[model samples]
Target: MLYWWSKFVLLGPLLRLLCRPTIEGVDRIPESGGAILASNHLAVVDSFFLPLLVPRRITFLAKREYFTEPGAIGWAKKQFFTGVGQVPVDRSGGSAAQAAMSTAVRLLREEKLLGIYPEGTRSPDGRLYKGKTGVARMALEAEVPVIPVAMIGTDKVNPIGSRMWRPHHVHIKVGEPLDFSRYEGMAGDRFIERSMTDEIMYSLMELSGQTYVDLYAASVKEKAAAAEREAARSDARDAARVPGTRAG
Candidate 1:
């Protein structure tokens, strides 16, 4: 009830008017069955805008932090997310990741449309990154088609570190459903999963027209942070050598 109310009465109408999102091939989504919406993560807004535009309800596997936020504001956020049917997932590796995959498969098997970010994290830059194999595993386990979606211009509407949303034209392109039924029983095979994941990422790249990076987004972010820290340390050392500055 809350999901429908928010979609039609509250946030949905407001977001459409403000963002003016353009979605093409929305019909590509299965109207009455389970399927996976494999999308490239650009901005945090990607999740909100995608759900607002799609007629069918989209259940995204959100990080646990979103559901566990502290304080009154956090409580509101938790309620909002829960009302929208988003599931909390622990992205940490090993058993946690496996549990998430199982949860997604269960949703699909129960005839629900599940939104998944193949890249596993938001893009540090505008470029698309290598996809994680979890999405592939879910699709195969659920025996559902994977629909590639590209969300364009969401970053401009709500860039990282921005508190307020600005007017920006947003477009969502839905690609044809990708079938991996041939690899149905091979979900346990890493090679098969990797192949399937790469294929989905390629489709997103083609749709979004962003440069593709072979490395995972998480690894790239870590490297970038390390570089920044090293540069800051070097600058500090240089400053300490100056005659007027105190050395540490």
Candidate 2:
């Protein structure tokens, strides 16, 4: 399979020799069964790292673009994702948010390990954001355990838009499974979903130690973008005033 082949034969070996992800509490992950590995996304490589460490095959909900491509490269990519057990999720504009959830639910129903980033996206500054309630809903609906995975130092290994990866010691701390059997048969209840989501976020917050933003990362990115525009304008003015430089 492209997934495990690419990971074990390619990325896994390279990362092991390079980034050298240090794992902790790995025993927390259930050796078998369909449970949700709810983790805080830190870097692009976060997905790559976690799978390598976990012995069992884990699947993730990735953007649909990853699956929709053309030609040999595209085909290989599709094969890779499929081999690794990733599903195509449409998280772009003009799509309903629930669309992503629907696909994920189907995966859970199959009794597979559904790896979800509770923060929805990778943390811009490696700080954990408010987890979307979808993880909770899936756990409650599927009657499965929610495993919290706290990833540290991955952002430094591969930054948000970095073209290269640095050799850094990363940590993947797998937390004990959070039992939600008490909420069995209460999946459709809105109040139960919210409460359970909050509980999962709390555990993630403790594990990540990133300032928990009550708002989603998308909102935070918007604010950050606005700030960057303002800073860019200021820098442009400063660069224009350099001596002997023409303002063409």
Each model's Cα RMSD:
1.5, 3.0
Q: Write candidate 1's Cα lDDT for 18-121 as tens digits.
A: 88888999999989799999999999889888888899999999889988979999999988887676899897889998888888999999999999999888
What lDDT score is found at residue 184 in candidate 1?
Answer: 77
Model 1 lDDT, residue 11, Cα: 78
In candidate 2, stretches whose alpha carbon ends up further than 4 angstroms from where it belongs are 93-96, 229-248
TM-score of candidate 1 relative to the true fold: 0.95
Q: List the residue pairs that clash in candidate 2.
A: 3-84
- Minimum summed lDDT over a 10-residue window in model 2 is located at 92-101
Per-residue alpha-carbon lDDT of candidate 2 for residues 45-125, written as tens digits (9 for 90 to 100)? 888888888887899988788888999999988877777668887886455557877777777788788898888788888
lDDT of 1 at 68: 94
Query: What is the C-alpha local distance difference test score of each model?
Result: 0.91, 0.84
Cα deviation of 233, candidate 2, in Å: 7.4
- Which run of 10 residues does model 1 get worst, by summed lDDT? 5-14
Candidate 2's clash total is: 1
TM-score to true structure, per model: 0.95, 0.87
* Model 1 misplaced regions, further than 4 Å: none
